[model samples]
Target: MKTERAKEILVQLLRIPSPSGREDRIALYIMDFLHRLDYDVHIESDGEIIDLVVNPEAELFYEVHMDTIEPRAEPFVRGNIVYGTGASDIKGGIAAILLMLEQLRKENKDLNVGIVFVSDEEKGGRGSALFMERYRPKMAIVLEPTDLEVHIAHAGNIEAYFEVDGKEAHGACPESGINAIEQTFEMLQKLKELEPFKVKGKYFDPHIGIQELICENPFYLIPGLCKGRLEARLLPEQEVEDVLDLIDPILDEYTIRHEYTEIWDGYELSEDEEIVQIAKKAMEATGLNEFGGMRSWTDAINFMYNGTKTIVFGPGNLDISHTKNERIDVRDVVKASEFLMYVNEIYGKS
Candidate 1:
């Protein structure tokens, strides 16, 4: 695929607004693009997952998300970087994948490969989860912004809501009422006193933090209810239930209600795994390096949990994702596409 063609696809993808659940238009665009290549393609999960089957029996596949956190503005290029929402987060990777597919078509190369473009990755990875319910590939390459590195492992995460119940009373009669906000603080304090959860292969230990909070009450009345969203990053050896059990004592101290919104266990691939070795070789061949572990969760967890040896790789930096200034170097996109081509060639032979 030509560099200009990759940039053109990137621009088109960036212009579309696909935030989490709303990925129809972009999914349609991808379906159309793959369809034009005369590949057997279909939409699943109510158009949230686009499955392009170049070879149905292929054990090796690639996955990339079409969804972004939110659309910030129309994409534009400045010098070597393309700046806009989703540009660095994933559109650049998506573009690279499409360009690689085009190259395969142009050269009439028949290889065992499948492409999965899923929505809802940013929200809860529902699209990938839905795909994994039926199809299981032996290996997969999850395209996320990793600055052109071979990402072997990453921490998993769980999203949950913590609710505290307290008695409400007039502010003037302070002793008659219990404040839920105060109860929340007390719970956090107790939680902070425990040792942080750790695992050997993970990049970091288990971490728990509050993402959002809400307490409603009139000025004259004390709050009776408080709710906050909590996120916990987990390692492969760390179970969500185990972490909850650790915190259960503190929660039991108060009248707390906990609801888990999303949960994904972490995963790690051995350095000697055949897929990892192939990716490392591909990176070296493409003039890139095998970087360190990814510190955050991604859709890769979904694939790994489903019995696929999955690795995270792509262009740009994860830090630049989900920001107004999200961007990727055009050169990085081209390099990733070339690297992926090598991986396909080498892995296909094995």
Candidate 2:
């Protein structure tokens, strides 16, 4: 595949607004591109459901996600870099896959490889689960931005939402009701002291975050509820449910007069197996072992949980994934695309 052409497509994908469940246009573009290449392609009607590409009776497969974390922040470029919302998060990775397929198509030989670019990875793995239930491949190469290194592992994440409830009463008579807002604040204070819930972490570069409380309509009446969201980075040995267990008792107290909900489970990939071996070989062949950790949650854990030897490897600093100034070096894009071509050639059959 031509590096220049690949960059163009990468920019185009980055320009599309594919946050979570809204990946219609981008998915359509992928299906169209694959179809034009004379490959069998199916764009699932639900948009964020699933996509399938078959090698006209061939084998092998490559898997990726077409959705992103946000809409494009508008496109811009400076020397050696392209700046946009999806540029690094995985657009560069997707570009690499597209280019790899193009290169294989030129060889005058049947690659017998398939491709699937799913949706909803930013929120969950419904798209991937759809494919996993209906099909299985010789190997699955999940494309996430990992610079040029072969990321043999990725931890999971638990996006948790905790709420506090109270009785609403006239503010004029303050003692008439309990205050859920104040209770939520009290719980937040306790959460800070919960022993840190430590674990033997992996693929953990120690990433963390917190945001302001959700907005609610204000009135003279006491507020009936208060809620906040917290994200925990899942480690190989730690289950996403562990976080829920840690907070369950604290949550149960509120349950007597409130509500409790668990957003989702965190996922993890612990072994260096089939996908890992193939990735390592390709990296070794390319002399690109200088790889680093995923440092956050990704759909890698979903694939791993489904019993597939999945790895997260591609090109881009995940640190820069969703920032307003998000960008990826053009050189990195080309290098990752070239590196993936080698990975596909090496693992496409085995």
Candidate 3:
């Protein structure tokens, strides 16, 4: 696809506000775009997800999430970069997918492939879970912000929310009363000493920390209650129950009230797998040679859990995703589109 056209599509997609649970608008735009290409599009999950079938019997498919974080930003183009929310997180990848489909339609090639655009990826990943219940492709390429590298492994996570209670005391007094915030910190420090938190893998290291901490003190007295959310990224070899078993004792020691918000296992695809081999070959054909593990949880986990071999890949730096300064280079979109096309070609031959 032409660079100008790709930028236009990306800009249009970025302008729509499809945050988390609200993805109807962007889903409509995508359905219309696919319809114009004369492909059979199917709307699913109360019109929150879309499935476009280029070949019904195709075992290979591409998937991308349509939701961004809340409060979408206005889209703008400056030189080769397009700036906006969701620009890097996923809208850029969506644009690339559209361009690849458009090119395939223009060429009128009957390649064996399908595409799925799902919602709720930024929140619960229920959309992908729903899709897996209905369709099971032999292989899937999940589009995310990977800067064009093929990611065969993805990190899993255990998210917990806890509340600690302490006796209130004056701020000026020392050792008179317990500080709930300090108690929370102590609990976190002890939890960090768990063995799983320090485990390292060939492509990713474990990340364990508190993502959210809250303690309210409107008066001069120390806070009596503290609430925190802890997140732990586990390697493929780590077991969720094993880590939780180690954590249960520490939480018990602090008498912390906690609950698991989310738990999902990490996964890795063998380098000798056909999908991995073809993806690497496609990246090489397009002058890309990077391969790494996805440090973040992606829809690939759902697909893998449902028995589909999946990989994560796309354009844009994940570091800037979900931030106000999120942006993607127009050239990167073009390169990603080219990469997808090559993947299609190589996979078709195999």
Task: Name the candidate that leads on lDDT.
Answer: 3
In candidate 2, stretches whose alpha carbon ends up further than 4 angstroms from where it belongs are 1-3, 44-50, 56-60, 70-72, 109-112, 165-186, 205-212, 215-225, 254-272, 290-296
Per-candidate RMSD vs. true structure?
A: 2.9, 3.9, 1.6
**C-alpha lDDT values of all predictions:** 0.80, 0.67, 0.86
Give candidate 3 misplaced runs (Cα > 4 Å). 46-56
Could you give candidate 1's per-residue lDDT for residues 1-350 as a string of tens digits?
36677778888898898888778888788888888998877556644454334454678888888888867767898877788999988989999888888888888986556778887888778888877886898888899998888888777677778789988999888799998888888877777666654334435566677779899986778899998987777776666677777766776676468877777677678989888988888888888866556667787888887889988999978886877788988788889999889988888787
Q: What is model 2's C-alpha RMSD?
A: 3.9
Candidate of highest TM-score = 3
Count of clashes in candidate 2: 2
Candidate 1 — worst ten consecutive residues by lDDT sum? 46-55
Could you give the candidate ranking by lDDT, starting with the highest?
Answer: 3, 1, 2
lDDT of 1 at 9: 83
On a 0 to 1 TM-score scale, where does candidate 1 land against the true structure? 0.87
User: How displaced is residue 122 in candidate 3, in Å?
Assistant: 1.0
Candidate 3 CA-lDDT value: 0.86
